[model samples]
Target: MHTDSAAEPRLAGGPATGLVAALDIGGTKIAGALVDDTGRIRVRVQRPTPAREDGETVMRTVEDVLAGLAASPLWPGAGAVGIGSAGPVDAFRGTVSPVNVPGWRGFPLVERVHRATGGRPVTLVGDGVAMTAAEHWLGAARGHDNALCLVVSTGVGGGLVLDGRVHPGPTGNAGHLGHISVDLDGEPCACGGRGCVERLASGPHIARRALENGWRPGPDGDTSAAAVAAAARAGDPVALDSFDRAARALAAGIAATATLVEVDIAVIGGGVAGAGEILFGPLRRHLATYATLSFVRGLTAVPARTGTDAGLLGAAAAARTPRA
Candidate 1:
């Protein structure tokens, strides 16, 4: 899924040659697909992500996906493997240490993927970075030269694309918007910070608020952000308030980031972002309140158009970039 470039040979839906294997490894699922060069998925398979399993077991699962892909008729000319994984990753070293998944600390991910796929050149990238890549290539932010993309799912993550190139920064964790502090005295973040954006705007944060406020559905006790969004949609006061808080936090952060970078658009994706207008409406309202920068005044916050396949497509596209 490549975007339109000025005769630079952007690979947008090209002729579908060379089977490129795409893997998206997350806390709850491991999805694999054989995508053609054109970005069309020829064969796709999914397996439950065993977050509790050690790195070795997860590697085995990854290898299992390759075996499944090979059985498809559309997977004959496979030449490379691209992986979109949870952070923090050392893209230069092809390694990862997803804090949520046990035994993933310093896992040699790229080498494992290469070995699993018969020594094919494998590319590894942060999920947030990969999402940004996908959006630039084929999704909502396609033609934008500078944009901030955030994935608000099981966790909050982000990536920055500037001047039409992916910016990995010094350690490949450059665009981690979740780690930024919005409140000096907010809840404790897993990253060991007080009141980071993640603790305020992520799915877990919203759920934690519901738990603390005793908001539930008929004695179910607590609800996820998704459930909370549903309640908010139905005019539930507590749920609506929870969304308001999350949106306000996100808006403040987004506005700050936009002012700092002068990004033209802010693209948001992931499970939690499905809250739609309930979330976006409040976020815009808060942005108006916190951001006074004229350059960022009219920045658009749009939904991600890539869906779930973005990670894989982005990984493959990133793999196409020349490494230093």
Candidate 2:
């Protein structure tokens, strides 16, 4: 499925050497891949997310995965270990809240990854930022100079690429797009705010609103944006309405983002993004409605081409970042 011409991978800053272990730690799963210099993954593995574990336990699970990778062909040969972890991380400090993982409040991630990865040179990055790097280097955002990459699943997260480089701010927190406000009078957010875009546009919020509208099927009735998209595709009125609401909120966010950044495109990814046109069609319509500037009008949102392995590619890119 990968169409890019493959290039020979060399050691970090030298002749292409061994593989880089890419780890993506999420609330639902931990996926790892041994990535080559050409962005090719030779081995892939995933395990259930530790739903009940504390910070130490989560780190243990990560260590176990790395140990397994080290014992297999996927083992790091010469490259480093790279991690794409959930935020909000103090990237400069290599620490994070670990979001859905309860025990990891300000866990030292870089140190953990280094210890678990056999003391290899390790790089830690935001999951959203990693996704954007993967897309820009090899997926839908490939060849584009400026664009936004968004993940719409468990949480709404984003990253930016400007002038051919991932735009992690000086503090490595530039593209935290979900916290932007859409309705100051809206719902409460985990970040302790009201009416943030994530409060209204995230997958859970979509399901919550659907329930309040008496959309039916009870609590078990379609709890994700993907479900809404399916129902919309099948001509379900309530489902359509639910997605329309998401589109409206996301469109507003898009318009505001485009006005500020004026990117060529916005590449949408993750679980919710699978909704395709059901979410994207209305999303485009909504963006059009709010756009007033000529630059904003030209902005289009496209689906990301990279799949689950995006995190690894991104992590590799981060490891290769020249020190400042």
Candidate 1, after superposition: displacement of residue 218 in Å?
3.5
| Candidate 2 Cα errors over 4 Å, as ranges | 1-18, 73-76, 218-221
**Tens-place lDDT digits, model 2, residues 1-324:** 000112211112221355777888888888887877788888777788785787777877787777667778557373676678887766666677776888888888777776666567666678888898888878998888888888887788888887777876644557777888888888778889878778777888877777678665536665566666666788878878888888788778878877888777889888878888888899888888987688778888899888877777887666655433
Per-residue lDDT of 97 in model 2: 77
Per-residue CA lDDT of model 1 for 1-324, tens digit only, reads 111111221222322346678888888888888876667787888888778987788888877877898788766577767788898987767788987787799888877777777777676778998898888878887888888999998778998877776666654666788888899977788899888888888887887787688677646744678888888899988888888988888887788888888888889999889999989998888888887777888888889999988888887666555434
Displacement of the residue 39 alpha carbon in candidate 2, Å: 1.7
What are the RMSDs of all candidates, in order?
Answer: 4.5, 5.6
Question: How accurate locally, in lDDT, is each candidate?
Answer: 0.79, 0.75
Model 2 error, position 245 (Å): 1.6
Query: Candidate 1: how large is its RMSD?
Result: 4.5
Best candidate, TM-score = 1
Model 1, residue 310: C-alpha shift (Å): 1.9
**Number of backbone collisions per candidate, in order?**
0, 7
